[model samples]
Target: MSASTKPIGSARGPAGPLESRPVEDSGRRGLTDRVYEEIKALVMDHGIEPGARVGIESLARRLEVSPTPVREALARLESDGLVTKRSQAGYRATELLSVEGLVDLFDMRRLLEPRAAALAAVHATDEQLDHLETTVEGMRSHPVTGERYLVYRRFAALDQEFHDTLAAASGRPLLAQAVQRLHTHLHMFRLNTAPGDALTTVDEHDRVLRAVLRRNPDRAAEAMEQHLSGSWERHIAVMDGNPAKK
Candidate 1:
């Protein structure tokens, strides 16, 4: 899609138009955040195709923002693994993870996330638990199908939020940061446009949430481990030319 065709401060995915924070109502930091979010949506929706060079001035013109905020947003996106900067080459959207990269990502997640779930089970506040439940419900609301990434962006976003929230609830800031740095959902969602296992994913999340809600660290860890293993298998199947069942 042409950058000029997209409206400033708004992004469209297959589901609908994603709302943006008004740049005029916020301070510098808020403006940067808005720019960051809009750019992220554009990248996620493939409006800015993967590996395409991102022109700061062009993006600024497209979003009707100054280059400052666009620069700041691109820096943040680089950290999020959604974009990358090259020496003397400026910024470009990062390519989707390879099969080997996916394997490595899941290996690290298997080590970290199960522990995070265990810790969250023991240390999470009631409010955090409530939020987790609400997020899962939100996922339920956005069922996945044989559609493009834009069509299931809400599900993808909620999936990220659920994991991020669980990681933070572990009461381990460093661990939470590590999990966030992985950007697992973003990379995985970008890996395949048609995700067919929405119901299975939601059910797996429900299992993890239930164990955490019950304050069962072992069970929570086990549930998380199972979920990750299952997820890895599902993605592997997709990569192998077979989509997982819905």
Candidate 2:
């Protein structure tokens, strides 16, 4: 009955028929993924407060499962930067970026994204441009209201796709890889803000797409700069106006 010695589902007694074993195995695998998703939802929805240590045994008991799946889920979350693990500290929700840290992050983004946009303007093929337009259309279709959480997720995906496509269209593989490594979209979602910024983001993306489509590198770069600057200010304002929002 102790936590450390608990079996996940061993109380089922003996294994079933050989054919049915795979179903059991599949179900077991599904449990781990389900646990992962539930934990992720807790983190993303701020159900578990930020910077709080996640107690594995407590979570397992709450979910009516063993600690193994919870541990597995925490491992995956750590990789996604939603959870942090220390030497002996186990896991805690990743803390919000400080205002100074946010500034530094935006500074790096400003240096690279504008250059990428300019290169994309010069080099993007017709096919790439079409893809970019499609991404923009998808973003525009998802207004930042109603189910704001779901809409925010969709908009974030389209936004990531839009930027990744643009970075790749720059015809520099390394540049694309570098941009992807930053994991900017994931971190932004972890900020857990209302969707007000999403509307402005769509407009900024439109401006960038327009400049790229027009083959104006200077204009593209300018638009990208404006977007980054505006985004930084918006985030800063949100963080400052409501210290408890994060």
Candidate 3:
């Protein structure tokens, strides 16, 4: 049987689970979270490249944390699909994307996200619109700062946040939850991209914003879906997995 090459537009809005707001640990053992979140971010930040064998001792030193937390964090990362454990080596970063997998994912997007955008347009409030505008403008103004460099490591994350913001504006928790779960898999296909990819992304976001501001659900959803479709095609090249450019 042939495989489905859908973009999982099923992620139209963040339809599944809202990322739990960072939780506070009531007890001392919970402090390990410092190491947990830090190490997890480090990986997402590309402190570790996919398929790169990670040395636990070395990473602990880099993060200025003890081996215990670093090791513990890596365990969590493994569960998250952000890292892969090798039988011979301790762990390595997971591949950002495989062409075959992405084809199917995009196909799904073609199904879900456009509809989500339309719903968001109808439901989003004034505050959501203002926040969306601020996010886009911030990206434009700070196109190439040190923080921008930070973004390169986590473009997948920034990409998710941008989308999630709009989904949240829809004020539907289930919608955001579903989309967030979908993106967790989506991050796996990441390939390095030019700053232009991000800027163009922000521009498309602007279109969705403008459409939503007008409360035109169809236009907003189409604008958002078209924007992501164009993005996946244009930057699909980045996932070729060449040595990441510095």
Leading candidate by TM-score = 1
In the range 84-122, model 3's lDDT, one tens digit per residue, is: 787877777676656666676677666666777888888
Computed on alpha carbons, the lDDT of every model, listed in order, comes to 0.82, 0.75, 0.61
Residue 55 shift from truth in candidate 3, angstroms: 4.0
Q: Once model 2 is optimally superposed onto the true structure by TM-score, how far is the C-alpha of residue 163 displaced, in angstroms?
A: 1.8
Q: Which model, 1 or 2, shows the larger TM-score?
A: 1
Every model's TM-score: 0.80, 0.76, 0.68
Residue-pair clashes per prediction, in order, are 0, 0, 37
Q: Which stretches of candidate 3 lie over 4 Å from their true place?
A: 1-49, 75-80, 84-91, 144-158, 184-190, 239-246
Q: Give residue 213's lDDT in candidate 3 (0 to 100).
A: 86
Model 1 regions lying over 4 Å from their true place: 1-34, 145-150, 242-246
lDDT of 3 at 36: 64
- What are the runs in model 2 whose C-alpha is more than 4 Å off? 1-35, 56-73, 146-151, 192-194
CA displacement after TM-score superposition, residue 1 of candidate 2 (Å):
21
Cα error of candidate 3 at position 216, Å:
0.5
